[model samples]
Target: MEHAELDALLTPEAMTLLDGLDPVQTTNDVARVVTRLRAAGHGPELVSAVVGQSRLRHRAAAKFGEFAGRMLFTRAGLEQATRMSVSAHHAGRFARAGLRRVADLGCGIGGDSLALAALGLDVLAVDADEVTAALAAYNLRPFGDAVEVRHGIAETTALDGVDAVWLDPARRTTGHSETRRVRADDYSPSLDWAFELASRIPAGIKLGPAHDRDALPEGSEAQWISVDGSTVELVVWTGTLARDGVGRAALVIRGGSAHELTAPADTPDEPVRELGAFLHEPEGSIIRARLIGDVARSLGAGPVAEQIAYLTGDADARSPFATTFRVRETLPADPKPLARALRERGIGTLEIKKRGVDIDPAEFRKKLKLSGTEKATLFVTRIGARRTAILADRLE
Candidate 1:
């Protein structure tokens, strides 16, 4: 970020410059007017206004960044933290589940740490950056009395015996931001590092939902956790871990509904796609736990193809594994003819779901000129040796 860029984003000092407010000045006007006030000497009134808006804007941006982080990191793009509020039962569940005496390895702004503390858990949250650590401490101050914020790299921190350790590794490389990656071995607190600690005590490691299954360590309970139907983070549990028939669980928050599903673990070298009356793509947890079979069995569904995560059956199934989309029509895959047919059907809104094949969804939608028509599910995959797209609608 350059100095000019920094000016665009409010610095702590820039925020202090806007003081006081008219009861009537809207937030937008305050920000815009504050920009002008910066040129004139800042008075006590202007400074107060800036501080008030500063607090609001800081919190909003932090919330947004955290939301984006959770989405991109999860399999189903789950929203971990939100203004929507936490579930009371879910809050107590983590506490009842022996997550107390917690060690939040990378407590980014204390989102999880705060949630844990709210449930009466004693959290020893740690972070590497002095700035972030300070900010985390400030954010967590409201939890009061129970939470202790520390500053250090968790990989090097001495955690002799904690009830449960949370390993949220830092993926940012030395300089360039694009250097972000998900190398288990290279994280500041690598997966191996977390797993090694977990081997000693109960530990939960948060990983990218798009992780490779072949790389998972033995003797760990792998869970694909989702919130509100969207698969969020992959949780690896070691010690006291159970091999749930299905690895994927739709973790319903608070007093809301919760669904736990599983999938069969697949042999990577022998990949296959399952098709049926309804094809349910189990969440990552189901895939990693290799419990897809368990989910299909529970739903009375069968595999469309042998190894593919997709399941099929003559009956409509209610499973958290996948959204139920009915087969409105089925035909062979031909881009030009399919587009023409769709255009005639007045179907312009498309959701291209791809599995075995590699075709860009955006490019396909653009080429098809999808707009102002209708919504439909497009499945692009390979059957035998050819790839095709099947347009369908929600089953129920």
Candidate 2:
């Protein structure tokens, strides 16, 4: 949003209009609201700002829940903000360590700062963008004197009184909306400066889940977190916030429950073995943390093929770290033979999963020419040196 539009949106009249309007969710909703507001004699700027904000609030609900109704957001800021559930976990680290004051550097829309303040910890939330800083102040207004929102550069901000720091350096180009990803070398405040700050004080640095592991600093705990089935972010913990002797961690959150697997360092991969009755696909967080070995040991499983993430075992086991599938049968790997085999089994709806294979699932699905009532999953993968197809059923 432009500064003028933001100024228009912040007025008492605009805020009340936004609050009174029903939730705007679709293009139809936007069009209807725009027409009604324009007909009511509201100026174009106020109408556009309110309509745009309403649309953003609908999208932000996935990350902020019900709190999104009152909060404001820019497109890029909302996209980069951490989910409320994940932010609470980040806040828990500081609260558990007995840290009372935290400086949340690059506090986009105050997602993490809100979580920290909600736990009764004082917060100094700083964002380099003026509009983002204003939105942060508004979102964190409920915390009253406990939270202070500042418009300033994170590297130059004074941290004299804070007990710890939470750094989420800008990984995208500068903008209030429509920003593109920037290279790691171009990160705002610079990783070098951020890492140096972490070394002297308890800190948590949030980065993309796929960040290069080799580039991470030594003697710190790297934790990859996945919400539902999607791996979200990697957090590097230093000083007191870093758990003793733990170098890698995977945290998986599915629905209301959460599970964590931790090891002193990257666990070695298990030796490859023949396919067992059940196949296990490790969660993204586990794969990213390189802690699949620990989960495999717990489930009495081994890799299906060398360097493959899929695990196989005969044991009846269920784990939060991996999804288990019961093997039904092995089929011919060739597309023509596989289609014939699937047709003979009366399989109609097929869930195609592939690894170490070049075929696109959608195109391959069309080639099957399927026509039946039964449903099954087809795993197109390599077994040792040969390509193979495995028919399986997901074990809930």
Candidate 3:
């Protein structure tokens, strides 16, 4: 957003209009509101800002829940903001370690700062972008003196008197709306500096879940978190916040419940064995944390193939760490024969899952030419030295 639009949107008139309007969800709603606001003599800047924010509020609901209604956001900031549920867990680490003051450097839209302050910890939220910093201040206004928002570079932010720090360095180019990812070497508050700071203070540094594990600092706990079914972020904990003897952790959150699997280090891969009665697909976070062996042991299972993530077992075990599927039979690996086999069984509504194979599920699905009322899952993966297709049903 431009400074003029932001300045105009902060006024009493514009804010009241934004709050009073019905939920803006569709393009039709946006057009209707824009026309009405313009007809009512509202300036182009105010109308554009209010309507744009209305659209953003609708999108922000998935992250902030009901709190999105009263908050402000920039397009790029909203995209990078941490989900409330995950940020609360980050805050819990600090609170559990008896730390009360936190410096949330690069606090995009105050997502983490909001969680920190809600737990009664004093927070100094800093953002390098002036507009984003302003938006953070407005979003965190409800916390009163518990939170302080500042516009500054994270690398130079003063951390004096703070018990811990939360670093979310900028991983993308500078912009309020459109931006693109940059190389890790180009990250603001370079990893070298961030790691140095964490060594000196109790800190939590959030990074992409797929970040190079070999580049991670020693003596820090690396935790990979997945919400619903998507692996979201990897957090590195240092100093007192880092749990003793725990170097790897996987946290899986689905709906209202959460489960965690932790180990001193990445567990060795379970031995590969012949196919069994059931196949298990580990959650993305577990795969990212390299703790698949632990989950496999818990279920009395082993890998379906060497270096393959799929696990198979004879026991009917259920776990939050992985999804279980009952193997029905093996089908032809070739698409032509597979389609004929699927047609013979009258299978439709197929969920195609593939790994360790070079094929697009969507394009492969089209070749099936399916027409049926039944449903099943097809696993196109490698078994030993050959590609294989397994037909199965998901066990809820």
Give the per-residue lDDT of model 1 (tens digit) for 343-367. 8788877878777777887887777
Error of 2 at 231 (Å): 0.8
State the lDDT of candidate 3 residue by residue for 1-396, as single tens digits: 889989988999999999988888998999999999999999999999999999999999999998899899999999999999899899998999999999999998999999999999999999988999999999999999989999999888888899999999899999998999998898888999999999999999999999999999999999999999899999999999999999999999999899999999999988997999999999999999999999999999999998899999999998999999999999988999999999999998899999899999999999999978999999999997799999999999
Model 1 C-alpha RMSD vs. true structure (Å) is 6.5
Model 3 residue 266 lDDT score: 94
Which one wins by lDDT: 1 or 2?
2
Candidate 3: residue 162 Cα off by (Å): 0.6
C-alpha RMSD in Å of predicted model 3 compared with the true structure: 1.1
Off by over 4 Å in 2: none
**Candidate 2, TM-score vs. the true structure?**
0.96
For residue 175, give model 2's deviation from the true position in Å.
Answer: 1.8
Which predicted model would earn the best TM-score? Answer: 3
Best-first order by lDDT: 3, 2, 1
